[model samples]
Target: MPIDPQAARLLAMLGAARPTDWPGVSAAARRDGFAALMRMAGTPPAVASVSDVRIAGAAGPLPARLYAPRDGTAPGLVYFHGGGLVAGDLDTHDALCRALAAGSDCRVLSVGYRLAPEHPFPAAAEDAVAAAGDALGRAAEFGLDPARVAVGGDSAGGTLATLAAGALRTRVALQLLLCPALDAAPDTESRRLFARGHLLDAAMMARDLADCAPGALDLADPRLSPLRDPDLAGRPPALIHTAEFDPLRDEGALYAERLAAAGVPVRHRCHPGMIHHFYGLTGLVPAARAALADIAAELGARLAMG
Candidate 1:
């Protein structure tokens, strides 16, 4: 399949303006790099209402953003923002979450989970689990239906979503993963195919793993990498989206296969001519909105089932 022309152009422009060794750079520098990249993309503002509220967690109060659909009701989503678990927060991904809420018509709870190099491995994963539990416990307070809830995210957020679903089990209605960073192990077809030209590079990914699992956790551990998870049998249905030119694409695809093998319902799509960050290009890339519509349809169907 041909890559989306718009995505190709965007990648070319990004490569032309490449920053020096982003992974090895300072944490602040990497964060700034992402901000600059998004600014360049000129993403649409989040149409969903935004709130900076706190939820109770075993650790303490956790910050989160609630994106209510205009027509509000059941089928709420708990979203984790992508940033390799080292950067990005509710604010950084506000626009994407807003678009998701408006586009999918599902209330979105953007979890502001703790990051790494400061918090590290199980920290972000733990925060995500606690936040999901907190949301479910207070579903009525958020005007959401307790029976219809989905968990999702991109990149590192994708890992959190998968972990959250597995950790919460029957509590979630479905799982949505976009170019998930399911495995940090450097051996995958996507890595070989799009290692350089794709918006996300292997070097930066390596850096993310360093920062995210700096503590006593193993990067190859299935608990951290859904691809390696021994059993995905009872997990909720899933809608997994991958990009042709993404390094993490194979991991997502493999996870989908694993889920299916475990009898978990799964729908996986590999968008051609698209890159790792294409999911967030809802404004710039037509394929992005198309993908979102597919996701919205899936969410609607899941809500109907519940």
Candidate 2:
């Protein structure tokens, strides 16, 4: 299919906007812009309940939100938001988290991991691993079934989720990824075709990597790019969703292919006519709403107990 008409309009609106000053914008301002994008998601899908909670992070207490669509034990997910690893927070993804819990009848935990230009690369990665371990070890505290706790995220978060799941091996139930940026150095056709003017700015993406992984000589380190990780066997199953027009699409699909080759169960889907982070643009694109529902169905089927 061609680019979705609705998505095209959204792209137009974005194109008309004032450009951001990259490598100079403060992290706080970047986060504000990131949240503003999510505002277009319209009203978030309602869930049964929401709770503010804390999980042990690599450094200290990590503030988190738990969304439960039903009472009693259910499948759980630790979700990370998309912001290129330098921006985004719990509030930014609240609605999406609600929809996940409501749609899948799961307990969804949205992690507020540290951002870049401040906490930097290793910090977020460590927190992600710690949070997943903490959640898996104490699922009962969040009314979750320990055996079904999954780790997932969007964009940069998809990287975090993969790291956490890979670090813990088969203990994690699943790795649910949405437009994950898995390669620090990428040379894919998608990267060249959709490098800019598609919601995600490639130059800005370069800035994000510099901000988050400053001074890092090796980009292929699995901690920085999970796609480089060699030990895929015995890792939990994965469901990776990539947007057809996203620069990060090919890398994610490549990771899925690699995982399957390594004997890990994986499912990769490239949603046509969608851009990066399209799953969070429900208000701007009606097709995105359907995309979320489709993803939710996959989540429900994998976790079993929708």
Best by the TM-score measure? 2
Number of the top lDDT candidate: 2
- State the C-alpha lDDT per candidate: 0.80, 0.88
| Number of backbone-clashing residue pairs for each candidate, in the order shown | 2, 0
Write model 2 residue lDDT over 28-48, tens digit each, in one string: 777888889988878987787
Worst 10-residue lDDT window for candidate 2 reads 18-27
- What TM-score against the true fold does each predicted structure earn? 0.93, 0.97
Write down the TM-score for model 1.
Answer: 0.93
Model 1 Cα RMSD, 1 decimal: 1.9
Model 2, runs deviating above 4 Å: 18-20
Candidate 1 C-alpha error for residue 137, in Å: 0.6
